[model samples]
Target: MSQHLLHTPLYDLHVNMGAKMVPFAGYEMPVQYALGVKKEHLHCRDAAGLFDVSHMGQLRLRGENAAKMLEMLVPVDVIDLPVGKQRYAFFTNEVGGIEDDLMVTNFGDHLFIVVNAACKTEDIAHLQAHLLADVELEVIEDRALLALQGPKAVEVLATLNPQVREMVFMDAARIELLGQECYVSRSGYTGEDGFEISVPNSHAVALATALIEDDNVEWIGLGARDSLRLECGLCLYGHDLDKTTTPVEASLLWGISKVRRTGGDRAGGFIGADVILTQMETKAVDRKRVGLMGQTKAPVREGSPLFDANNHQVGIVTSGTFGPSITMPVAMAYITTSCSQLDTVLFAEVRGKRLPMTVTKMPFVAQRYFRGE
Candidate 1:
């Protein structure tokens, strides 16, 4: 392990709980606890699992033109985003490729952004270079982000502060929980219902301890986090999504609001608008992202090539894992558009053998978001 690896606010708590620490994105993060990856993944599905996501970049963009300035970088309708609602967006390059994906929440006074850990440094610099001098960008360094996810997530969290019970999926708000004023969102990468809380660093350990003390909650780690997100068909940065892949090619066109597209009110102002919008109109992309499942128990992994019936390489796997929740080996890949259709048969080259894989609909399981009644 690198000696200069960074530690999260709950590092000592993870270590004392017998978590196996590993290096990721320059941080010594817990890969798994004594519960192991498979059990931890299942525990989250059945009960609740807490994650230390402090390594991710959290920033505040404050100014009257903040959202308008942010729209110049992402191909989403930022300016019109209603206050207290959160939206998913991705940064695009000049060539219509993804730079990084992020979440933007309209806080009335400012926009709160959360970016991927590995891309934070570059994302910060990108924002600094392009955003206006008046749009204040503040990197929040004194807070820790924690995600509490599962079927019982609401039940457990509501006990701490019943006000949270009113928040539905994608709702963002600032509330006082356990004596700490925290920024919280009823959202998570997992397909289950959950909440991501950003609390002051000084109170992080205390907050985590309070959550983990419940019999319904346990400490989860990165190893299980990957499997959980993969099973839900969520893309991981630098893997399923990258600078080489555009939102259209990655099946993320839905992320672009209709009003931002060619015929709508705020059309073609973002970076890569020409190419991405053309792709949207023509649908002539050579390759596309799709879901696949193996015929046997053998696990197919990333970088494995996919072949058609004629043995011609059509695509490559980007993210693969055995889904403990689904009890099957599933993966996502970039296959030729013609071969990316649902129910299309393909093969993944694992080791020296070509194993059969079928193109199936993503999110092998149902996404259970807690949308309020």
Candidate 2:
């Protein structure tokens, strides 16, 4: 076990539930409970699954210039983000390489940030160093995050706090559940209609316990979390995205708002603007990340080499797994821009053998995001 591992508020509850513990992103997390990965994945897809996501980093930025400071580090039009709405964006280096992918929710006077656990330390340092002196950066270390995901997630959550059903996807609101103030966002990584609830550490156990009491909700672990995100074609920071991959190569152009991309009134003053704007104008990205489906039963994995019909190494696999929904092995890889077209034939080097594969549209499994009616 790694000595630097941190434990979440629900760590003991997971161990008591017979979860398989593992170290992930410097945290002692449960990879799976007694039910295992496949079952947990299915449960979340077919029903509701509770996840402890406290390992993620949460920060609050406040001041008259918070939005301006954030715009300097990201490519999104933060100034235009409506209050009470959350937007997905990335932190970029000076060269346009992705430093980290994160979600920023505008709350009128302040902004709430949720970043990947692996990049928390660096993200905080970057913000503190670049933020204007007037802006206040506060790390919420005394909070815990929990996600309730699936088709029945809303049904389960509605029972606890009826107001949650009124929030639309990508929208957040402060609500009182069981007399505890919580920040509830209608978003998640599982590609399902879910809610991420942020609560004080002191009330974490009670909230989790209350949610778990619902017969429809089961405790899910990191193992299923990985499979769920994979089915949804979501990128895992360290594996799918890294300092070497730029936002353009990662197929995350949608994150850059049109106003920012075209240099609206704000103009292009953010980090990596030169390279990002150049890529946008020329569409000259070298490799593009795409989804791949294996023709055979073989399961491809990370570090797998990708080859074209000429047997030339074109790219490498970033993440892969046997998708429970598709009942086949699926993978994500970076391929030459010319060969990134859908239906392009390729091969994955699995266990010293080249397995037949083809480029496919992402989100191998359809998403079930619930937008409040």
Candidate 3:
């Protein structure tokens, strides 16, 4: 039996543009267009690329205890997150394992959150079940999300609304685009200067069309999206993160604010605070997420066994791809802490051959996020 796949508002436009479609997160989404993945990846790095990210889930949390309630689930300093600011965080489980990684924006009256498409359902259920007392979770089902990314992103988008240029990184505003109200944020996964716009589904086509017509903008697809994010060292929800992976092991300690840790005022109050705090204090994580740079053109894919000097298996690749921007194959993996140091030598077993790989710093491509002066 075929699974019933949902279609985003821009599905027809994608087909009309000669995009190759595939099933992703229960939705029929474009994997690549006629321009191909390599071209799309280069275009985004050189100019601007428009991506249909409507498959992502958007939700609003209301009530006076909205931030307080959310603090019980994640380690971010939500209570102090100023209005109009966005923070990257993860929804952690009771044992310090990650349930889902997400973005939380304090919208003054309500909190706006964006979760991974595949984890949206469970994320909402978790919130409702745990925060039933005072917080209300309202799914924003009537909006379509679009991401405009690259070096020329700011220039192209500023032409639509000059106010967009005024906004800094991680700052959001309720702006009007092509005569429609949109919640716009200056943030993205591709490590570029970009904006993620959430517009009403009714006017999604019009907005997308307007952006596509821009000279600097090209329609991008999932293939390039994956490559772009990989080069940027961003994690894919299902592959790089799961219930068994904790933030400490994932090297995402930056997401947990100092105020939320053991010595802070509101210490260790979240679901997995105990385990997470212990790992932080003792640095006792068995495995750590590290970047693998392949010396050859062959891309080392996920699940490939990583070996040490003695050819003993130490870990496995979690996400790997040909980084078009960097023009090489790069991968992310969790390996024994002993081998997680920079410049550590390792071998990836791909096919029947062993390939030499070096542990390198992530974000193979430099990020151009527009943080204000």
Name the Cα RMSD for model 3.
1.1
Q: How much lDDT does each candidate structure score?
A: 0.94, 0.91, 0.92
Best by lDDT: 1
Poorly placed runs, candidate 3 (over 4 Å):
1-3
The residue-by-residue lDDT of candidate 2 on 1-373, one tens digit each, is 7768899999888888898899988899999998889999999999899999999999999999899899999989898899889999999988888999999998887899999999999999999999898999999999999999998988888888898888888999887878888888999999999999999998999899999999888999988899899989999998999887888899998988887876477766789889888898899998999999989888899999999999999999999999988899899999999999999999998788999889999999988787755
Candidate 1 local lDDT, residue 304: 98
Query: Pick by TM-score: which candidate is best?
Result: 1
Looking at model 1, report the run of 10 residues with the lowest lDDT sum.
259-268
Report the error of model 2 at residue 329, Å: 1.0
Measured against the true structure, the TM-scores of the candidates, in listed sequence, are 0.99, 0.98, 0.98
Q: List the candidate 2 regions with Cα displacement exceeding 4 Å.
A: none
Quote the positional error of residue 283 for candidate 2 in Å. Answer: 0.8
Give lDDT tens digits, candidate 3, residues 285-356: 899999999988999999999999998999999999888877799999999999999999899999899998
Report the Cα lDDT for candidate 3: 0.92
Better of 1 and 3 by TM-score: 1
> For model 1, what is the error of residue 157's alpha carbon versus the real structure, in angstroms, after optimal superposition?
0.6
